[model samples]
Target: GYKGDQIRDFFLTYGDQGRDVTVNLASGGSPQWYGDPQTEDWEVTLVETGTGARIKRVAAYLDQPYFLQTYGDGIGNVDIGALYTQHVASGLVSTVTGVHPTSRFGEMHVSGERVTEFNEKPTMADGWVSGGFFAHKREMVDRYLDDDPDLLLEKKPMQTLASDGELGVFTHEGFWMGMDTFRDWTELNGLWDSGDAAWKVWA
Candidate 1:
């Protein structure tokens, strides 16, 4: 049902526009289906370790001393440049953008152009959670992660980093949402079509 040529053509069109985007299919355990990456533009980034490596797995592929990282399925309007600058100034090994994700279902009283009151989901008052936008020092990976692919980046490394004062945080008081449900998908599509998506950073 899927035509590889058509997809390749679509990619080529984008490539022609000077977009140096590399589509990587990461397959673990034993490489099946996608045996090898044939084109120079696209590649199969292989991770031989078992599974559940999470950020640690992806971090290994990066060659930069510091690289921006974010969840592919999450959308946010965080000021990335500010976060990077803060990270550099703090001299921390890792920095996660903390955010107050909009409440899923809540009641808000808006007067004129301001919200008078909102009683809903846990906000920044409840405490901040990792927004998935990160600036990581690549060398920290080897210091924190091991060969075990089952390691979760959030479990020990992050905690240890925080405990050792080696981690920094940038709070984002802007729009943020994770697309995880059908409702989220529909709403994101609606927002995209409406041309009012707050996370449209380029605009």
Candidate 2:
């Protein structure tokens, strides 16, 4: 697992019953998972924190656009590879993809010396890092903010870093998902409520 203090700022969870806790974006949009009703779902691993019960990590199937819109603005923009390229070219980032490349989804092709390309696939590691539920150091946050005032930590910095080859990635050997639209949310939620969600971590 990634280590750092800034990880505290990235996720949110709510509990209604012992087994009815819900997790989603902490600061933006409605607090619901996004994507296809049948496939867009999350598996939450809870751990004890100083604050109380908190999510350790989440295994999620998300809708790309919805995830980007919800968390993307905070980071910068959601184009993982493009954002990183921009940062690297401008000296805004130092390391890209902290973890292995295989941890990422979507089309991320590395071309000639220091050149990379991103495809239209929704969840690729093009301009962003593999940060879902991962932790971060407080120093990283300070470095990120000091560089860009308009920076949305979740969206812009990762892209900026990737552009500069300073972003780090955490490859997870597990299931993942994304939901990009309202319809996707509906479908995923229906499946979750029906107890057939493939991404369910509760039961």
What is the TM-score of each predicted model, taking all chains together?
0.67, 0.34
Off by over 4 Å in 2: 1-131, 146-150, 163-165
Give the top-scoring candidate (lDDT).
Answer: 1
Worst 10-residue lDDT window, candidate 1: 30-39
- Taking the tens digit of each residue's C-alpha lDDT, what string does model 2 give over 1-203? 23323443333322212233245556655544444333325553333233211111121322121111122111211334443444345432233322212232356567666538766434434443342433333334444443333434446565665565655443433334445457557756787799767555443
- Model 1 earns a TM-score of 0.67
RMSD of model 2, in Å?
A: 16.4
Give the top-scoring candidate (TM-score).
Answer: 1
Q: Tens digits of per-residue lDDT for model 1 on 80-178?
A: 999999988888899999877666778688999999998875454567778889898887878887756667777888888899899899998888888
Candidate 1 lDDT (Cα, whole model)? 0.74
Root-mean-square deviation of candidate 1: 10.0
